[model samples]
Target: MHAWMSEASLDRADNRRKVPEWVSAQWRRPGARLLLVDSDGQVATDETGSGPAGVPTSGNYNAQLHTFLGLVDGIPWFTTEGPIIGPSASLRHLGAVTGGAALELTVGAVALTAWHRLEPHCSGCGARTRATAGGLTRRCPVCGRVQFPRTDPAVIVAVIDPDDRILLGRQSSWDPGRMSVLAGFVDAGESLEQAVHREVFEESGVRLREVRYFGSQPWPFPRSLMVGFVADSVSAELTIDRDEIEEAAWFTRADLAADLAEGRVIMPGKASIAHRLITAWQGRLLG
Candidate 1:
């Protein structure tokens, strides 16, 4: 599993939060570290360094450079619009090479940055918003309304038939032969299990039962919280919705191995929860 999929050593005390100035003071403490992410979502990492590399600098905050991410092991960790001191790497690569420290900061920063970029005004009053709560929130000066970072909850389910075959689907827009589990966003008043059932039925004309949670991951490519599940297939029919899915099919472990070797099917990247779910059901990791 990707380390970044899980939480890190940081303690995000959102309930008993510190003020901005207090958070900044942690930067001056010895052994403090700074991390940064580009506008495109890559973490600033040294190409030659081992294990979640980060930029090296004294603990000083540059207003335009750093966004206070949170406390890492009780010390300040910041992200920046960096002219990073060194080369940078993608979060996917970082996951294979490192632990949660760098990955957590990068993901949090990217989420924060996305919110700031996408929301600049209060929805309630059209007032300009400013960073508050140690960069964890945005406040409207006039209405005093506060906005925090938001993650859209989406359910990604690995559906299985009584025969134990796994169901996978491919979107029309995906790369050739790429396949993944069925997924959809939770609707206005629906539960996660309801979304799973509805999405599966709508996309493939299949019904599912026993919707059980598997795990979750932070997929912050423009901010989404991927809630994972495993569901037993009640209907084996394959009726692909042309609007959403181009293809839907069932595969056994042996079939997956053959397709993987022949390059007939491309699995999800290791950085994604889909990959872990697939490997888990197969009773082994893909080599």
Candidate 2:
């Protein structure tokens, strides 16, 4: 199956169009729709009655209504929902609704909603910016700076050795025996390839060669674009960085398959680009 089929599809066409009159008419609608919030890495999804009541609000009360590409069954449709935020005094009237699964919501969906609302005021001069192009961008009236949604690039890599073993690292806070690829945010003035090599060396003390790019995923946990790669390890010896990683080592395909079969090793989330990278490597080895 395609990577996006698991999550609700947010059609691009829907996002381009103006909010339909029928949807706006639902402003006074009684029922609420699904809303999800993410602070750091923690996620919470719940229902809210309607969009924010007024424009000028503070704390978690502010809301930016977004139209997302969505699907019901195999048919494509659009969804108009509020941004991610906790319960506020202004939104208390929505009545109680159950929380939804975290994986069901995409980071793109949440970040787009929040950025649209927070950027109304210009960063340069505090002058109020005007929304343009159907909420896709903001134009600063004073400085004339056009601002769009921000996406931070990150690198998540699987380090491979000449012995055909894959390098994995376990964070100090993660459960025992759980291992994942070394990852870090791409710093300014660095390419994705540079970030991959630096992160692997810093976390596991493994020098890499033959670095090749893999696919990317929209990891919106809080606005991250995950760039995946496979790098050849020049050294087989392991050196774990206690501050960032608790353990680092090379594992063979047989070992990984055994662990996966016994549920001893847990892969990253299916929604995560990391999982897809690992799965791709496994396929090649098994073949």
- Model number with the top lDDT: 1
TM-score of each: 0.90, 0.67
Q: After superposition, how far is residue 79 of candidate 2 from its true place, in Å?
A: 5.4
State the lDDT of candidate 1 residue by residue for 180-231, as single tens digits.
9989899989999899999999998888878888888888878899999898
Query: 1-287, model 2: which lDDT tens digit per residue?
Result: 13432534433334433444433333323332333433333223333433222221212211134333232232222222444455321211211121122222334435655566556788888888765543456779899988877788999988888888888788989998787888999999999999988888888888987788776766554467788888888979877789989887777889999987898887765546667667778888312
State the C-alpha lDDT per candidate: 0.76, 0.59
lDDT of 2 at 44: 34
RMSD of model 2 against the true structure: 7.9
What's the TM for model 2?
0.67
